[model samples]
Target: MIWLVSMYLSSMLFLVLGSVLNLGLSLLCLEKGLSWFIEWEIMSLNSSSIVMTLILDWMSFMFLGFVMFISSMVLFYSGSYMSGDMNVNRFMYLVLAFVLSMAFLIISPNMISILLGWDGLGLVSYVLVIYYQNEKSANAGMLTALSNRIGDVAILLAIAVFSGSGGWNFLFYVDNMPKSDSSWLVCFLIVLAAMTKSAQIPFSAWLPAAMAAPTPVSALVHSSTLVTAGVYLLIRFSPALESSNSRLMLLLLSSLTMFMAGLGANFEYDLKKIIALSTLSQLGVMMSILCLGYSQLAFFHLLAHALFKALLFMCAGSVIHSVKDYQDIRMMGGLVYHMPLTSMCMNLANLALCGTPFLAGFYSKDMILEVAFMSPINLVIFILYALATGLTVCYTMRLVYYTLSGSFNLGNLYSISDESSIMTSPMIFLSVGAIAGGASLSWLIFPCPYMICMSFMFKTLALSVSVIGGAIGYVLNMSAVSYELNSIKLYNETVFSGSMWFMPYLSTRGVSEKFLMLGELYQKVGDNGWSEYYGGQGLYFVLTKSSGYLQVLQDNSMKLYMLSFLLWVIVIFFSMI
Candidate 1:
């Protein structure tokens, strides 16, 4: 009890202090238009040097503030969510380590230093994902770790490519780097690293799988830490991408990720997976927008999404806890009647996610959509952006209908209530941010408003799609007992979308099946077959048989040995004669 109290109080204190300090520093940097680079020489050799670098700028400060704030809430909430678990302390420590890794990544503008934090985030997140000690958790952790490992390798390759520049700090080189083969290689590597970390398409299967972790961790991972690291890194590397053709490729991949996630979420029923898919969708939005040359908007959305998404996850945690650990939306209904506060917060976060007017998502999402519409993007990208925006609302509305509006669906004996203040307190705290974070971040991020001059139809297109999507989503999910599900009618399409377009299969079994089969063949022909006959086993068999024959001769009587010796001597004499 004492340890738990100490952990909670200490985390809250740090959260409060960190948030205030970072916010103040961010404002000061903004006011002065300042960026401070502090370098400490670790060692110097002949004609070369090694140093650690830290950069303090408005972006770093602001991102740090958001991260610390959300982490504080998550830790506090974990005190209750994981209270019964025996390894609660271990969980708290892992969460802190995760925050530390993110902080390192946030403050370092150098690729070498960033890799330190980058690898740390990946390693720590794998540990966190597997915290539950179950097969699902283990598999999810492996997927998460291996997927991020690709990014780690890309970063290492980028570091090698960056060696030619004589400095590991990319901030100085990104804008001024000359166009060369090495430069393009470095850019491609950075983009690959970012895409994998951000869980962009082909690499996105791990994001939802990661929900196997504790829900509090999900709030932190999806909202601010693990997933956002990629977008944040790319924000720092935006200059490199801006000049390269890689931006087009990133734009296409990210937009597809966005559309796929949104579609997948609409078919998803698991509470946490729905939210996870939403996070992936939002990440795609950030990456796509950044690729379109609006890193600030991407950063703004990242911050705002962190706020509401954290709140959303916390609310989901509350609901999941109250419902006896059931995560299926089908198992939950009329939750508002039991946990009004939680339902309200969940709905608020959902609304914010949908980019409802004047909310945090609206300020950033609305601007991003407006900018995307006005950009010289092709028609396919435009259609994807528009449809994805609608699907966002579609899933939110579907979730709301199933969880909040339906009749009580749990077994009659189950009691559901949001009586845990330890958990609810964090939700309320973040609800304030969810409600106002967008507008606040908008004022701070964009000193000048985005000048989006589009026709009336185009301007209102997002709003129209959202409204129609929400209505359809609600009406479709709200079914009579006699009515069949549309999903049943469109089974193939539903399966594809719900399955993330078979990406998880492709990522896990689909990709591994052939390799696993090859391994089996090797085991049959080499390790167990040919190698057994001619390798160590075969040598052992030959030596064992020779030893047995020698033992037989030694065990023979002395008379037999003498007679054999006489016969051998006579034969030798006859041959000599």
Candidate 2:
């Protein structure tokens, strides 16, 4: 037990040191335009050899530094969060393994090695998602795993098609690939794989469901590690997708995902699920920016978002723990009076999420929106981006109103206090990062600022939308008023938004029910009915009748034997004549 506790502390220290070292390395690389890579041949194939390769450029180093920092905090928090469990040591080990998998993903420059990390992330995350070993956890785990399996399959197919390059190392050919049909197909498949990992559009259902995992896992995996893997892939392969038609398709789908998730977040009430949906919305933002040919900006947002989001999840976990495991925000109110520090952290994270000026989200999100406005995109894309930006503020304000302010809504108000030092300490550390990460990363990522030509109206569009959304959120959740909106009485609209447009039901039950019904029909009509009768029963009847005739012929019954002998003799004589 002592060793386990020491392990968490020691690992946290190691990660902190590593992060600082990597940060220096990244700065050097950025200044010098230097990249380091190492490769070793592992196996010899027909013409191409399998090799393990590691890459260290500005992007890889910076992302690695961020991942390690967040992961270290998550592990530190988990020591307190999971201390009561008997499997706490095992949990720590798994978390370490998960971090290592993410590291593998970050440094690998080859497709095959990337897949190793990719699949490792998926497998470890599935286990983490179902760590509680309950029915809900199990079901959510399956949903998470199966959704990612689509990406795995897509990657396998991509490898098969890309084999024409005579090797699986995409970094070498990404810039030199021929403009052929196979190349286009490979690009399309790569986008498809990214969509799955990032939980974009049709693949979006699994993310919120995965909130069934423990809170520390949620903080690490959903916020920083697993979810960002897809965006990183897109950022790496942006060169290949620059001119492909798939870029347009990605832009359309990702923008829709952004709008849909933001709207859904407004209607969602669960504390963790709202955060999960917010993660989804942010992912959409990253993907959309990547589609718009701004990979550096996308990567910048990815890092900034990771900092605040991990902080956000940790804060949410703190609140949930304080309220006796209650996750519904409707039941939580007046928490600010009791848990001051936690509420402050939550508010800061929420404000950052809303892209408040000078905060972490402001740095990257503002840049992305500004770039979007200046890009040669159609009005539909522009409008969706604007609306989604507004909706982000709207939902975040709604969450704050329900969870922190207003009267105490819990049935019995027990004395609720802040968490122990073990938990709050990590939250404090992340809160600092969430506050300053954007500005720091902005300087590091973009040495030269982005120049945009737009009207004053376009310049303030994001802030205006945020203001309007904040107003709407306040009015909708005012505790002083007893007014009810008749619009909410409309079951269909409410159900659609509240249920994320029924995405979870459609992805899980809708598909599963249809397939299950098909299986039943097959059992009744084909297997039990036709197959049993025609194949089994028909064969039994034919064999039984033949056996009966043979038995009669051989039974030595005098009349039967004599009749058979006479018929045979007559047939033989006629043939001879």
lDDT of each: 0.91, 0.89
> How high is the lDDT of residue 344 in model 1?
94
For candidate 1, write residues 399-434 as lDDT tens digits: 998899887889988888888899999999999999
Q: Candidate 2's residue-wise lDDT over 459-573, tens digit each?
A: 9999999999998987777842367665457868877877777788888888866877999999999989989889998899999999998888777898987887999999999
lDDT computed for candidate 2? 0.89
Residue-pair clash count for candidate 1: 1
At residue 393, what lDDT does model 2 achieve? Answer: 90
For candidate 2, the 10 contiguous residues with the lowest summed lDDT are 479-488
Models, CA RMSD each? 4.9, 4.3
Which ranges of candidate 1 are over 4 A from the true structure? 44-46, 480-483, 516-577
Candidate 1 residue pairs that clash: 360-438
Among these predicted structures, which one has the highest lDDT? 1
